[model samples]
Target: MLFRQFFDAESSTYTYLLASGRGREAVIIDPVKEQAQQYLTAIEQMDLKLVRAIDTHTHADHITALGDLRAATQCVTLMGEFTQAECVSDHVREDDIVDVDGIRLRALYTPGHTNESFSFVLQPERPEAVFTGDVLLIRGTGRTDFQGGDPHRSWDSITNKLFRLPEETIVWPAHDYKGWTASSIAEEKAHNPRLAGKTEAEYVDIMNNLNLPDPKMMDIAVPANLACGRG
Candidate 1:
């Protein structure tokens, strides 16, 4: 399998490129608009066809490259079924399988940061990799103070959905502000300050009191992302 992780310093966002092999169909996840050209270059260099561009949910921090990639490569634009993005070509639900060549990812509706937030778990053969988009971060969790966010729901999603994965499952989050790249289910369960030993109520209280400020680009990014980042 071919995998590449790209970082955008401005938003601390991580974009992922996945393909079974060179010259084959590929998929990109949580792409940033400014990095569209970079993604195109990588695809061209690998001699691969971009078959799909997926966003876990509507983003409030950075514009997505889904629309741009679709325009350039004719790839299908996808989002979770509950997303408000009207321009996506596909709306995936829980358990839905997204495939590109020999690679497959099963959609897991792990809503927390946003109502439509989702995490993609690599299929049966590679159950060890999970793309946790903004829902889980290294040592911390996504703030649930806005965008229809509910602290209780966030706690439930973490303890029930994500925690069910095997201990060794690799966690690749959408954003990481601490210069950390990846983590494991085991590591997070044992060390994540947000979830380690807290009960549901305690976790809810912690999230509710975070008092985090809104993202700097929320005003522009949210509106643009609702249109699939066409702006």
Candidate 2:
């Protein structure tokens, strides 16, 4: 499998692209609207066919380039069971396999950060990795105190769903606020401050401590992303 990762330092967001060596197909995940050309250029450089674009969940920070991707490429779009999903060709479900070119991604409906948030695993018929989105991160996990979020459920998603993966399974999150990236189930199990062997009530308490404000760009970004970047 071929993979490319890019970071938008301003929003602390990371977008990724994956393709098969055959280069006959490719997909973009968690793309940022402002960084659309970066993906296009990468596709052009790799000589791959852009077949699909997806987001693990509706973004609350910067708008995504999904709209732009649709208008620019003949690619199918996806998101996880979103009531307000923008241009999603598939309301991805747990265990649903998303095939693009020669690569396949399996959706894991590990909600908690939001009802529709998901983590996807890329299994290219070999050793593979997972894109954990906001559900799980390197040393940190996504806040479950925001809109449509729940801390107790987040605890289940983390300790049960995510930790169930093999210890060697690598993780790449949607945003890295700590300049952090990459982790294994073992690493997160041992080191994740908020999730390490904590009780459900304790987890809830910790989550409640995170009094985060709403994303500054949600109103503008959500609709723009849903519309595929309407002018």
Candidate 3:
């Protein structure tokens, strides 16, 4: 298993590259549209075959490179199974195992940031990690204020699903507010400042009280993303 993490400073989003050590086949997760060359160069230099480009959900930060990657490498495009299918060639389901050459990731549908969101668990000695799209972040969680974002649903997913994971499991979130990298479930439970032992009503109350603005890139990203990168 080979892995690399790329952070786009502008949006604070993290892109991950996971390649199969055996066959050199790779998958790109949440790539930035502005940096197609970076993604291509990395794969090209290693002589790896690009198989899939996946977005944990429709992004509110930046346009994704799925279409660009497909045009260049002919890789399959993937997203949450609940999202509209036109954009996602592969609709990933909960517990569905995605095999990329030698690396196999077990999918866990963790919907909080969005009803369609998912978190992937990479197996083996359990590297004790999961790629959490927007649900569980270093200091905060994704806002439940958009099209598919619901405060109640988010509370359920975090408390019932995500928080139930091993306390030691490391979390790689989609974006970090303060430029942090990874965090542990134990750390979040102890200091998340949001979930803790609060009731769902309290969680919703807090979210309702926040007059947060929409993501800067949402106006451009949503339409284009839904059209599968025609934007």
Candidate 4:
């Protein structure tokens, strides 16, 4: 397998590119518009064709590269079925499989950072990794304060849905502010301050009382992302 992780320092966003191997079809997740050229360069250098570009949810922090990548490579743009981003060329339902050049990701509807959020499990037949957009993070969880967010749902999604995956499945979150790279299901379950030993009520309380400020780009990013970054 061929994989690359790109970081957008400006937004603390992590973009992922994956392929079965060089010269094969590929997919990208949570791409940042500002880094479109960088992804293109890597794709070209690897002799891979970009077949799919996916956004796990409508991000409020940064504009997406979906539109740019599609225009550049004619790739299909995708999001979960519940997304309001009609600009996406395709939508996957829960348990739907996304296969590109032998790499498969099973879509999981795990909303609550946003009502429309979705996470993808790589090689779902025997899970290897999970791309958790914002619902589940390395050590903390996403803020359930806007975009139809709810603390109760966040708790349910993380504990009941994500935590059920294989303990060793690698966790790849969309954003990380403290320079941490990645974590595993077992690691998060064992040490995550927000979820480790907390009950559902306690988890909900934590999410509800985060008291964090909105992303600086929310005002612009949300609208732009709804249009697949062309807004």
TM-score leader: 4
lDDT of 2 by residue, 1-231 (tens): 788899987678989888886456888899888898888988988888888888888777888888788778878878887537646776788888888765888888888887778888888244268898888888888888665888877888888888888878888899888777678888999988887878889888988898777788878876776665554
Model 4 — TM-score against the truth?
0.99
Give lDDT per model, in order.
0.91, 0.81, 0.82, 0.96
lDDT of 4: 0.96
Instruction: Pick the lDDT winner.
Output: 4
Pick the winner on lDDT between candidates 1 and 4.
4
TM-score for candidate 1: 0.98
- Sliding window of 10 residues with minimal summed lDDT for model 3: 120-129
Angstrom error at residue 187, model 1: 0.5
For 1-231, candidate 1 gives per-residue lDDT tens digits of: 999999999999999999999999999999999999999999999999999999987889999999999999999999999988888999898989998897999999988899889999986465868999988888999888888777888888888988888889999999999899999999999999989998888888899899888999999999999888896
User: Under the 3 Å rule for N, CA and C atoms, how many clashes does model 1 have?
Assistant: 0
Candidate 3, residues 5-113, lDDT tens digits: the string is: 9988888889999896634899888888887889999898878899988888888778888888988999998987887637667878988888888677777787767
lDDT tens digits, residues 1-231, model 4?
999999999999999999999999999999999999999999999999999999999999999999999999999999999999989999999999999989999999998999999999999999999999999998989999999998888888888989999999999999999999899999999999999999998988888888999999999999999999987
Can you give the TM-score per candidate against the true fold? Answer: 0.98, 0.93, 0.93, 0.99
Error of 1 at 215 (Å): 0.4
Better candidate number, 1 or 2, judged by lDDT: 1
Better of 3 and 4 by lDDT: 4
Models sorted by lDDT, best on top: 4, 1, 3, 2
